[model samples]
Target: MKKLLVLALVVLIAMVSFAKEQILHIYTALDENEWPIYVKAFEQATGIKVQVVRMSSGELLARVEAESKNPQASVWFGGPAIDQIAAKKKGLLAPYRSEAVEKVPAAFKDPDGYWIGIYFGAIAFGSNKEQLKQLGVEAPTSWYDLLKPQFKGRISLAYPYTSGTSYTVLAALVAIMGEDKAFDYWKQLHKQIHHYNTSGSACVTQAGLGEITVGIAFAHDIITKGIDKGYPIVLTFPKEPTGYEIGAMSMIKGAPEPDLAAKFIDWMLSAEAQSLMVKWNRIPINPEAPVAPGAVKMQDVNIVPMDFEYFGAEKDRLIERWKEEIEYGM
Candidate 1:
């Protein structure tokens, strides 16, 4: 009787230990539309149980900042690379040298191993094709067209002070045209903007539902939802070139499961991981991943020459300028 009781206790301990090893915590800015695809694939590939926590870009930034005293998440994935860059500046991220990173371009991965780009997305105009035709407005093909009188009160975008997508848009424009011209452009474009939103991805959904004729947001978001939900939205970039985001993954500083976190980062940047991004309609930054059908590949686009390091350095000033000239309507 004593032997049988000890055997049962040992089995229970082993089972608990196995369960603990299978679970990993991940923090992300990706919404419901993007989470399931990753969770399902990550689990299947590595047998690591994923506990995903979703927050807005700003919210996630704040959370990371708040938890700096004692980091809770093991890995941070799927936020704007710029935010991750900013976090690296604050020592909120730990350096991770993943072998899988060799598959990514130098421009896409962090030089010091703080983060690695999983996919690339651009800030583009998402036009409701049916609504534009109904309103007798031609589909906007350029940044200047977004400021036309026809688009007045018919465009949606996020607020730069709070959203990474908007900030990326701001950074891209500044990189493309220089600060003075970029602000001048935004000040003019402000006239056509319906209102600044709190959530960047929300802008895309608003455009799909015809709440606005044009939406400025990440191209992958508009394409993913439109393809999945049958929304008649057309995603297009400007001919003059535009900014793009390198969606990234990073290990949190002092992660509890350091080995597991490093392994997760390695898996995340692999060709297999990049290929899984196709379900989200995202363009992989990895050259090895086959581009999804009907998805806009970055190589085919005229992307603006962006200095991500410069953008990271000047984010505060850029955000302040946006608030003064556009948000407060200076």
Candidate 2:
């Protein structure tokens, strides 16, 4: 009986130790190349185990909504800020204003502190020069150029419903050409689209592989992950103003580990943490943190004026319209 009591005590101690080492779950919209580095750094700094599942921003939001009652993730990281705003409106995010918030620019964060921007990148066309040469097509210089017959069945884009990058493109078009004209533009451009991809970066990858002549994605991704890797792709911004995404992070509402998640948020905003984005060719939200070499400075790009709150509110309506008018008709 005394030996049995010792065994039970040892088992209890083991269980307690296992519970203390419980992993912090993260639902991330960051690319796979970026997340592992972040997870490693975070674990090394905090001594907390992290398990991450990577998905597109829209998919991540859907998962968060589906699991709202019993949240599975402690945080949502590295998605467009507009998605974060939409999540906040749905009460999926917990508001926690970190001390690090003061270090971020006012334009990069939510006014109510539901989410914080960690980085930003601009939308551009990633064209394969060899593919374009083979097709006798010039690199597209404007959004309108994408509608040319030569581009037919050679352009790849992500569906706006499933991709933050594509949503940003839609929002930019509306802001640039007005809503009515933007829809009309998409109808014309639809003819050239070879396929609608689920992942934003996948289109760029296809372009790099020469499977598509042109891909609509973030310029930073095309440059670093595509061209730099000898994929024969070249990045070009539309002569018209382009949209940019302020990639953000937020604490999940009712997260199992809110305190630990908050700590992670604070750490992400630090200069040391933000600088890690350089490894993935992402610009850091903290001004003091240096960007990756070859990153295009925001000032050099003709960025469209984006109203995050307005776009966040209108996303559902716009997506529904796109489905009916563009996707269905296509």
lDDT of 2 by residue, 1-330 (tens): 999999999999999998788888999988888788888998999898888999999888889999999999999988798888888888899998999899888999988889999998999999999988987888998999898888999999898988998999999999999999999999999989999998888888899888899999988888877888889998898999999999999999999988889988999999889888888788888888888888877887999999999898888889999999999976
* Candidate 1 stretches greater than 4 Å from native: 1-22
Stretches off by above 4 angstroms in model 2 are 1-19
TM-score, every prediction: 0.91, 0.95
Per-candidate local distance difference test: 0.82, 0.90
Clashing pairs in 1: none
Backbone Cα, N, C clashes tallied per candidate: 0, 0
Tens-digit lDDT track of model 1 for 22-76 = 6688888786767777778878888778788887666677788899989889888
> What is candidate 1's local distance difference test score?
0.82
- Highest lDDT: which candidate? 2
